[model samples]
Target: MTLGTLTWVRALDFPELLAPSTRTAIEAWVAVDPAVADAVLVTEIDPGLADTAALTEAYALPPAASANCVLVAGRREGEERVAAAVVRATTRADVNNAVKRLLDVRKASFLPMDRAVEESGMEYGGITPLGLPGRYRVLVDARIATDDPDTGPTVIIGSGVRRSKLALPGALLARAPGVEVVDGLALG
Candidate 1:
């Protein structure tokens, strides 16, 4: 379907969505970059099914064919502010150890929803890595750029909506301003 024609299969507010912080961070990222403005597609679905399998099925997507952009927040060793990274769902982001070392934070952990929303202006269930503050380090999965001829060259990501998703070219996502391509960022 055309980008404009795309509709949100589901609708939910920030309170109902558990990931307000993720949504807020994404909003900040998108505000400065217009290219990612149309990349968000909202939808409503059971909150329990936020996982990849359920998300793909709800959207009628192929099996093992979904993108999981996880948001990790932590403080680096000398840094006073929290650092954030975005990674795919197929793999897990090493927030406690490896990530902490990379970010140089004494401790690393996921940011609470309230803090995420407060720092990021976007609502819950609508978080994407498109737009965010320059201080926030956005690490993207290199696999997101792999070409899949059968499914087309696009990566499906959350559109700040629980039930809906947005499809965009992997290259486009990588090219998004402030996005960093990291290999093996996620653990399958």
Candidate 2:
């Protein structure tokens, strides 16, 4: 179904109910341009948890056809801090070299799920790069932007639920505010 058809799953109004951190980030991105804000499409699905395999089957997607955006945080050798990075499902973030250089940290690592949830204010399978604290750098896999006749021009992303997903244009995601296009962001 088209994004417009997706149901808004939250119990409260979209603005009032979203986690504070998510709401704040979304609002700021919206302020960048009306189109960016308009792209958000929310929906409800079974809260059932699933790894990549289950998600792909439930969504009728091909193997390795999904894009996973992981949130990472850690400290550099000299500085005390936390940082975040986004990478696709097919590949892991180059934490050792590329990501460290990008984040300007001597070292970087994955943020545990609990911490990611706390900092993002978004439910675990629901986090999308569209709305994130501006502090983190958003990265997208160039391959995800390619057109596939079967899948249309959209890329499947979390629908704030484990059972369902939201599909939107990769180009749109690349253009969203706070998103930074990083070449070689993901490895096959």
TM-score against truth, every candidate: 0.66, 0.73
> What TM-score does candidate 2 reach?
0.73
Best by lDDT: 2
lDDT of each: 0.57, 0.59
- lDDT by residue for model 1 over 54-78, one digit each (tens)? 6656546653345665556655445
* Residue-level lDDT tens digits of model 2 in 1-188: 43333353322235443445555655676676656555554444455633555665654555444567778665666654544445555566677776767777766777788987777666787676755666766766565666544555556565433444545567666776667777776665
Backbone clash pairs in model 2 (N, Cα, C under 3 Å; residues 3+ apart or in different chains), count: 1
* Residue pairs in collision within model 2: 68-89
RMSD versus native structure for model 1: 5.6
How does model 1 fare in lDDT?
Answer: 0.57
